[model samples]
Target: MGTTVLEEVVRNYRGQPEKLIAALLALQRHYGYLPEPALRVISQELRVPLSKIYGVATFYAQFRLQPRGKHTVCVCLGTACHVRGSEQIFHQLRRELGIEAGETTTDGRFTLEVVSCVGACSMAPIMMIDEDLHGRLDADKALALLTQYRD
Candidate 1:
């Protein structure tokens, strides 16, 4: 049987057991998240158990089982943010994106998430899009932020 591209990724590791993380990262780089078939191929190619692969993937916050949207929107709901009406901002985002917390839009354009604190309370009511932290926002401004990301 021919090795799949996923198995080819595992082979790139050259069978070094210590390269498991590297191998998984390579796979994720190719396909947004760790696809199920790739995981199985990795297990077979590296002689590593599928359970261990899942364990490692889940242990790292950087790894994701589900595909992420082009944009990741995280709203901070810390006390400072909440006091500044972060809840309203979050709701506005949900309405604008048509996606509830932790859900990606059907078109895979955006993902909405809520975080208790992002250590940016000084900014208060912050919404982070990808790596950009947007603070001191009103509901309208927050909704407006989505415009630049729209197609």
Candidate 2:
């Protein structure tokens, strides 16, 4: 991120340690992941420890240290989803995308992940592509939906 922009973000939350999470979140939004230089700037400018900053970043799943694909595919493995065959769907996606869970496709088009639940148990056996949820899916149906995001 540009120093000017980073400075502005620090200025917005200057002297407010409680807003550390918010500042980090804003940086993540801008850069797609928390860049080390940005974190250092935040630590120095905000007088917070670098270790503390990293602690918070690592504590939350929302923060990503590495670059991510343009899209994230989350397969639910909750009890209801498991019973409905989400595992098979997940395996199909893994084979088709050539990536295991927590891995991004070589083309960076998609990142595959497994989540415990998305709170849509009624729509069990669901997989989410970005923010859109596709439910009641079999292996074939899940693969079919991938066509829409292939590009």
Best by TM-score: 2
Number of backbone collisions per candidate: 0, 0
lDDT at 74 for candidate 1? Answer: 94
lDDT of 2: 0.92
User: Residues 3-105, candidate 1, lDDT per residue (tens digit)?
Assistant: 7667578668655657789888888887888888888877877778889989999999878788889999999999999999999999888888888997899
Candidate 1 pairs with clashing backbones:
none
Candidate 2 structure quality by residue, lDDT tens digits, 1-151: 4567688888898878888999999999888899999999999877889999999999999998877889999999999999999999999999999999988888889999999999999998999999999999999999999989988
lDDT of prediction 1: 0.87
Model 2 misses residue 55 by how many Å? Answer: 0.4
Q: Which run of 10 residues does model 1 get worst, by summed lDDT?
A: 10-19
What TM-score does candidate 1 get on C-alpha atoms? 0.86
Candidate 1 regions exceeding 4 Å error are 1-8
Candidates' C-alpha lDDT? 0.87, 0.92
